[model samples]
Target: MTEFKELYVRKGSVAQDYIDIAQDIYVEINNYFKIIDCNLKFCRMMNKPRTELFGTSILDAIHEKDKIKFQNIIRNALLKKFKDGIIRSDLVDYKSRIIATTMKLNPILDDNNNIVGMFVKFSSFRLRVEDSAVNTIFMSIYNSLTDLYTIYGTDTKIRINHVNTSLLNILGYTRDEMMGRHVADFLVKNKDQEENIKKLFKSLESTGNFTGEVLYQAKNGEEIPIHLSISSLVHNGKVIGSLGIGRDMREQKRLESENKSFELKLQNQSKLAEFGMMLQGVAHNMSTPLTGIKSSAQLQHSRLIKFKDKLAEKYGEDREISDNITDIMKFFELIDQSVSKLSKIIKNMMSKSRDQQSLSKEALNLAYVMNQEIEFLYANQFFKNRVEKNISIQPDLPVIYGLYSDFSQSFVNIIKNGVDAMWDSPVKKMDIVMYYESGAIFVKIKDTGKGIPHDIADKIFDPFFTTKPKFKDAKGEEPNGTGLGLDSVRSLLKPYRAKITFESGPGKGTEFIIAIPVKENQTDLNN
Candidate 1:
């Protein structure tokens, strides 16, 4: 009947499907254990075609040690003694290579319910049960975690075997596109960074790991900066591969750059505030000479008017007229001296506050720079009245090539720092010596005050680091230390290829020495 035939067809299909389960290699064999039909995997395992595998005794492929066990399992299945008979066994391929495998057997029955053949499934042994479980857990974490960029199984030749989703997503590449590529292919495209890349690999091989910043290029043509840590993956006392873990450093690098920019702005603002305080003192100091000039002029005018009348009354007396003439000349001399002092003060302020854009590389006379800075320092009442300055200048000091403003600011900051260091000391003295030695300009600024503590001496040049109290100027306007003075000095000196060093001890004194190299072709302008 049609219903009976359809049922038989469905049953036959189900029986065929049973052999495909839980195995890569499956076959149908007669009760005599000769292969009648086999899947592609079975042919591949035997290293032969299906035509050659057909009618071949299955025992021929079974390893000698496993052959008896495999035959026993098949016989048990044929007898219907065990339904899911399975055995751990080994097989020998056509090339005589042994492969560990797990085998499963099931009986095939005929229409009369007699055992006709058997179905056998062989699964290749790749991982032990414990290793398989661990690998599964590792894969779950590797793919699930999204923040960390990971690369695994990078072999000794630097070929990339596996990359996590995080790295693939960041690099804009699929797993297939990145697999089997050299690790350096994704890194160090920039020619300037090639040397550093070589060093990184060298360190990795020598030390078993490397931790540093590296550049990675993405598929979208974007360059990514990464802080990568790569450690060797050792197996059986040999390094077989490497594991790389990385973090995206672009955001952090951006923040650091922005922070430096912000610090520079703060430094400029601090300088402006200090300049404003200096201007106030200079104005106050100028007022005295201005008052003297005004008062002397008025007195001279009144005295000359009265003398003019007396001149007519005593016209015949030459002695009185000559004496009056002499007194008028004395007043003129006093006014001239006041005008000259104001002029010098104005010139010093102008030189100190020159426009930054105008500060370009040129031959700078050290003596002139020191004189201008020293004169400007006097504008601060504390430096003028409180601290005693001992200045030594060598005649014809060699000229160094740099921006005038840079040199001026560096000089002033050092002197100002020395002055501030002596704020609490009873013997407040600052010694500044500038001389030429070894084809370089040497400037030594020393202060006899509270010296830098040994613990903090090394950190003095760091931005926003300070221990000084707020400085109250002539107008009583207190501006707190911006902590960028010495830091600014350090930055300014870098362009000139200069070096700054200091010697200090608690309660003894602090001395800072700056050495600026001179260009060989240039000579001292003063010479």
Candidate 2:
């Protein structure tokens, strides 16, 4: 025996001792084992007679499907000289029962230190197989719940876990095509979208959920609007990833835009109808007085001329009578001047009324138009004594395309309101300035009189609203005005697409600014 010192006998005792200790462990572990040269307990664990299994290779007893895997484990153990090795795999036996197994391989060495075979221990695969089936069912249910679900790590990189046909159709991409792509890469055309997605993830890190509108591009180069809802998944109180769901909103947005446009058109038509009614009223009121004034002035002038000639001839030689005749002549001169002023007022009113009725548009120098109105205001005796009106038409102002008479009348109405606000106030000064800005024309009228009361400021433009006391006038108690001064002004301006705004403070002053969009045909006076 080459002085082996009875190593087999000692080893056998050691092995038997290990088998005794492992007997209790194997019972607790629910695992089976095989021994090549020793132990009745190991053979009992496999439910086989000791002679049938003791000398057989472990692979011969393993299920066919698992034999190769076990062999590989044994080979690795032999090559690496591993004391112990583990092999995990699934198998189905000749009886058609599924088995999920974990095999532990331990190398057995002879007394001379040469490798022998191996000790193989394994557990029945039934429990593991059932667990795997449950996992698959859970995954199937998860995928069904989410049409286009993806998990994003804290780093913002997308990890696609589930997607349905609806999501694939909407995105116009195949599942395999989108699997590993970055979420932002699909939104490269819209930088804002990428930035927003980044911000959304950052917010999710803190709050655990985020919901908002996001724009995405499809494979067809079309922009798709989506409502993205994200929720963070937490495990053990730490945010591991986020889940995202997207709903398409492009059709909804289109419908909303259409509704808005229709509403705007309806509003404009209503405003136009109201304007027509106001225009009719203004024309009717002005035409009557203008016709009467023209008739009266002509009749008075003819009678006065006849009277003046008769007096001069009768007092040809009488000095006192001649002086009286001269005084009479001066009186007629005063009447003539008054008639001329009344004519100008009627002309301006007629022009404004005609333009309002027609809504005719034209491009005119704003400065020239404003100056004309200011001159008329200055010439009127009623305004001259009570107010000092000054006009500064900016030389650099561009021409504005609008209804000439309508634009002028709007300015006149604003200025007239300024005068009316100071009817009984001590202060009396008005300044009109016209300028150009950013493709628009602006006319500003400021008055150094008591401004409108804060309580009634908003009501100033209401129909039939007035601060003036009703009174019977010389024209057979003129019917009370419909209080449509500002109302008409606002209505007339609608057709021209102009805006009128005012700022006022008690005892400080009131300033009205009228802005009209400049058309391309508008002449640039500055250029």
Candidate 3:
């Protein structure tokens, strides 16, 4: 009989032991509670000295404020014969810190099935003191005190949660008047800003965060500019809402505008100074040729009259004297040639000067322009012998839209540099190639002479920078140039949107590439 009872009872104990172990491990165990009755596992979990806790009320450990709720739970459990119930409240732990508790209750029954009492189990749900203090510091620092702060819920409704003293002062409104209002109510002055705010919230739903400047309206119909930085508030790896901090930028915007105006005035003054210098150089350059032409004409006039008088005396007949007069005209003819040459130079100078101020938009044949500049450069005696020139233009290259004089000057400057580079070279050959790519015309001038030094390549295009020997006057004394040729070239090409680049190394050749945008509907030579 004893062995049969042991085997039957052992099967019932397995299920009871499983429940007892789960209650101790899976539930909170540091909370305040009183045990009315417990299983063997609960007895071990609480370290109780008694064998059973039946017939004991579990309300003995209840705090004064929660004793009424605890007693009500017990009475309800007895009336309903509840197998399990719960009471949620706060209690002080052994360390005297307030801890939140959720108590689990299990009612006991007598042999007649009448309610006897209840067993109580509880867990502590409060955060650690250090963790709570750190959270409070973070909240105080991140929260703005000088602006109206808002957080957007996941449903996209803006909730006004914080209003600082400065924001209330600016808008002439009390904190109560501003808090709890929608963000749109303050955005009345800027419809675009309101729409953008809506778009920002919608985007945040997909992309987590956004920040930008916005304009808000005050209660008195005034605009307030703000620099807003917004980020998503996340919890448990999920974005719950968005937080925004606003900084006023009205004074900042005014300062930026003032600075911009000052800079524009300074740039205009600089350009005017450059223009005055260019005019002075041009006047000085033109005076030499004009003086020479004047002297030559005066000398030729005297020689012509003397020759006419001598011829009239030798040839007695009137018709013969007329013929001799025509012969004397040849001397004047030479003077005309000098004057014509001077006129052409003056005309070219005038064209260059006018082109500096007014850029003309016309379709120009780049190859023809290159050839003209080369012909002009070759006409000079020094360049004629010093540089060997080869020009190859692709037949299918199209015309570019640019000012004629400006484009010609750009090519002339490069050709002049090429000639100057070859003065010391034994084999002075320059290869120029023109081609078209995409919508741009490219002219590459490559020279077979000592190239620019690698260190000064970038400085070559700078104003007044030169590698050429100092200019010498007619008596071999060094003369100074205006040192504005490359500067003028750079300034002229700015309006045309032209690009220039070069590749050079010592002993290896120098290559310069000029690319200009081609015009639509322009014809190519090959076509």
Better of 1 and 3 by TM-score: 1
* RMSD after CA superposition, every candidate: 17.8, 16.5, 18.1
Q: Report the lDDT tens digits of candidate 3 across residue range 345-457.
A: 65554544454344446666778777656655655876676567687988656756666767776787776676666666788898989998888888898887788898887
lDDT tens digits by residue: candidate 1, 1-527: 23322333354476345543424677779999999877766777777888988888989988999888778877876777874534688888878988888876656667887878876667777745445777889887987776544555545535787788888989989999888887788885877569767877798778978888888899998888888888888888987788888888888886785488567867775787577567757866877877678677767767776776687677865777767776786776677676777766765565556533343567768788888778767878989998888999886987666667777778888887787778768999889999988878899999997899999988888767777555553234333475778888897788667889999998998899998887742643334
Worst 10 residues of 2 by lDDT: 24-33
Candidate 3 runs further than 4 Å off = 1-32, 35-90, 93-339, 359-388, 391-399, 403-428, 435-440, 449-506, 514-527
Q: By TM-score, highest first, what's the ranking?
A: 1, 3, 2
In candidate 1, stretches whose alpha carbon ends up further than 4 angstroms from where it belongs are 1-258, 261-333, 355-357, 469-479, 520-527
Clashing pairs in 1: none
In terms of TM-score, how similar is model 3 to the real structure? 0.41
User: Roughly what TM-score does model 2 have, to 2 decimal places?
Assistant: 0.35
Task: Extract clashing residue pairs from model 3.
Answer: 28-123, 36-53
- Tell me the tens digit of each residue's lDDT in model 2 across 293-401: 6566566656766766787787655668656756765665666567567666656655544444444456577776676667657666647876876767787576566
Per-residue error for 183 in candidate 3, Å, reads: 43
Candidate 1 C-alpha error for residue 451, in Å: 0.9
Predictions in order: lDDT = 0.75, 0.64, 0.62
